[model samples]
Target: MTADPVVETLDALELVDHHCHGAVTADLDRPGFESLITEGAAWPGVSPFDSPVGLAVRRHCAPVLDLPRHAPADVYLARRAELGWAEVNRRFLTAAGTGVFCVDTGYAPDRVTTPSELAGAAGAAAYEVVRLESVAEAVAAGGVEADAYAEAFRTAAWEAVRRPGVVGVKSVAAYRTGFDLDPARPRAEEVTDAARRWLARGGRLDDPVLVRHLLWTAVDLGRPLQLHTGFGDSDIRMHRADPTHLTDWLHLTAGTVPVLLLHCWPYQRQAAYLAAVFERVYLDVGLTLHHVGPARAGAVLAEALEITPFRKLLHSSDAYGVAEFHHLGALAFRHGLAGLLRERLDADELALEDALRIARWTGRENALRVYGLPDGSPDDG
Candidate 1:
């Protein structure tokens, strides 16, 4: 007997990971690797398998390394250690079923792959997403005076987007100061005063005016702007990261640029609501997918899909620290999305053709249209 047609089709989808970070190129011990899988910024000091994302690695990722299904934690880690980082990267990355990667290279600079290196390992086309903070820090370090901070940052940002591989820009305002900051653009005096304080002290760009100004600059450039929202590591203030806090800014920036919201978890529905009402806003449930694993991904993705327009949802792994996330993230998404869509098809809620079309749109077409990539071949699987 044949298997379910809906799931079979989803298995063949070649997704464009609209947002992600490069994998670590260095070798890892069990704890080092374990630290990567969990959502926290620091190592948990205990075994990672006690968590959802950890247990998921044991159940789903063990086999990709030639270990048996649900291999014991110690055994899986041992096998991973024996394989070394190179083989591990190639195996997991090749298994991810992704054709294009819009890579954000600003995370863990010393330990991670470059966008070029990432593309070579995954056998996919890779593009860059410049982090606003990285560019700002560079300008500050160049000894540009605070009075020139605004102009210097603007010039640096302008030059960054003009680079060969850059396709978009991202802000971690959710990580720094959250989305609760005043939505109005700060006046030039406010920017200069804030810049002076930040530079004279520790040279860190923590000023709210500067943050707001950076976001507004991205809007002016009119490229896709990625904002980290909702759940993250310990660094994020959970309550302050809610995307609903972005309502005022989204309203003001409407029609000026495309804003991509990343990693919406407890706020997935809220993000979906925003995407539904705002023409320029879109959302993704990445990092969350792999953490929830295939079994629980449906509930989360269903929440995101409930109000999100089909064209406004895109795919991402948000994978970092390890390539296993790159593999497992896509696996969990395929399993979850296929299962949910199949149930609807069977219950007569959706037509066969329409179901497949939505699957294609969320998996790739949406990202290509949003990020302006030329359409890739269908067999990218």
Candidate 2:
């Protein structure tokens, strides 16, 4: 069968990966690469091929490294080791066709590229999204007294966001205390006491009161707040990470700032429900896309879009520690989403123009709008 024209058009559009983390700068032997692909947070000795994402790497990413498609996992790792880090990064990142990467620099700071290095490898521009948990941890580690922790965190956050290239802030509240905290901003004494208790206990910042404080601080700053919600490695209490749990806080912070929900899966429907009802909320099924791979990406996208307003959906890889994810994510989102819209066009359910319009909106335009990037859509002048 001839390729669908809309699918071809999608491949040409430049994507703004609105949420992602830095790629590894090191050369990986087999195990090292496997750890990056899985959500396990470590090399667990189990074969990476056992997971969908790992299988996806062998099937789709092998060719990008100059091997045959569906290359054996062992063969794939050997070819990758032969190519070395820089070449592998250059090949996959440049091929991803991403025009911008909004990078979160907090996670694995030493192991991954800085935002600038990532831009250089991909031949694209990048911006930073400060991670709140990292900043709070730094403050606690600096010997800030409990009474001073609140101001210390605010000052640090302000300085961090003001640094050149930072466009937003992110919270790992889901991974820390979950969204089940008090909806109201904690009282002054509550914050001070909570800081004292946490600090006394070596200051982990997972204290519910302090987490709520960090989130509210970001909201008050008025920059976008990217919250990790649903399907994070084994660290999260999956049940408590539900976006629906944030409704009270959502109501509290409504109209203060945009809350971008990252990595929603198994709860895309819940996320879509929140997006449908809350003007300040937006979501991406990035974790779902990369893990499920291109073959099944459409079904997830379809579910997310079922009750979501078109404008509220955004694209992200949520990829961390690898450039292969950067490539597969963009490829899957563009290819899979376009294929879904193409099916509708063929059945007379959607016009050709409508299909192309939706493809451009979801893959490129929505991110530009949500992240406040220039609309420079060709039609915009």
Candidate 3:
């Protein structure tokens, strides 16, 4: 009963998955649905979301197909139970040589209810849950609600950070599809007004309005903040997906508060640039790893590593279903790393120290630092 060497090596490294959306909802099951359809359909061996080739065919033929969405709390509990997060943590403790950091994500409306429940369920002493909330109310209040939301965020963030296992705040500012673009839309003006009010209240541009407020709040209270970056869902215009779009926020912050950029998709170059330019702008190369597989991921990672400081790079699965997909993502990430090492770095020249550093630093250390955890290795309880 020997373990696969690759699996064993990955296990021994104890990698930290910095960015992942562990919320359980049918919405997160989009990939699973695609897999099921592809598995059962006439066109066998065809992945609906397959890379460049499949993407081309899909663009030309099936462009804009609707996918299933999952419900929130129930989906989260179901997936966690199915994935055996508790068991996963135990196994992680056994395998992780250094340690692994798992940051649980919760959007605003959802966070108002889920965090307490999830904390009870996970039961691990050091698990972190980052909360997400809408800027809608804040926007309507004409900066009043925005200021209140900031205070609310601060209260929630500090509570979570101080909780037995909770670590930091995960806040999002923009909606790729939900918000109204025109003044005609109800409350649209409110949202925009709130943004203006928050800005007038000293909010910076490069920072997501909600996140900028949260970052300032978090930093003042001594907590870490994770912000969404790069391309989001299919509904979002690709142009808006660019992390470069946040240049104003970046310039405004100037590394004052540590920010973890989630995804960093097609805009890896821009992400890399931010990572290089701002000491606090850390990039999580996870969602892209899930959307684009190993080969492309290898190229992206190689390019990012070559240009960006290794300390700012983070690894994550960003997988939400049964732990199966999460494990798959981790394996895929390792394979991508191996490929990058062999193709870009000289063979046998990839030192274990560097590998360990990438695996540990990107995975957990940065997260631990951002979240302001006790200055010691993570302990699995």
Error of 1 at 2 (Å): 2.3
lDDT of 2 by residue, 174-220 (tens): 98888877889988899999998998888456999999899899987
Give model 2's TM-score versus the native structure. 0.95
TM-score of 3: 0.62
lDDT of 1: 0.87
Which model is ahead, 1 or 2, in terms of TM-score? 1
- Superposed model 1: Cα runs more than 4 Å off: 41-45, 376-381
Which residue runs of candidate 3 sit more than 4 Å off their true CA positions?
Answer: 1-11, 23-32, 35-101, 107-126, 134-161, 174-219, 344-356, 372-381
Cα lDDT of candidate 2 equals 0.86
Which pairs in model 1 have colliding backbones?
Answer: none
Q: Where's the lowest-lDDT run of ten residues in candidate 1?
A: 372-381
RMSD of each: 2.8, 2.4, 9.9
Question: CA lDDT of each candidate?
Answer: 0.87, 0.86, 0.50
Could you tell me every candidate's TM-score relative to the true structure?
0.96, 0.95, 0.62
Candidate with top TM-score is 1
1 or 2: which has the higher lDDT? 1
* Positional deviation of residue 377's Cα in model 1 after best superposition, in angstroms: 14
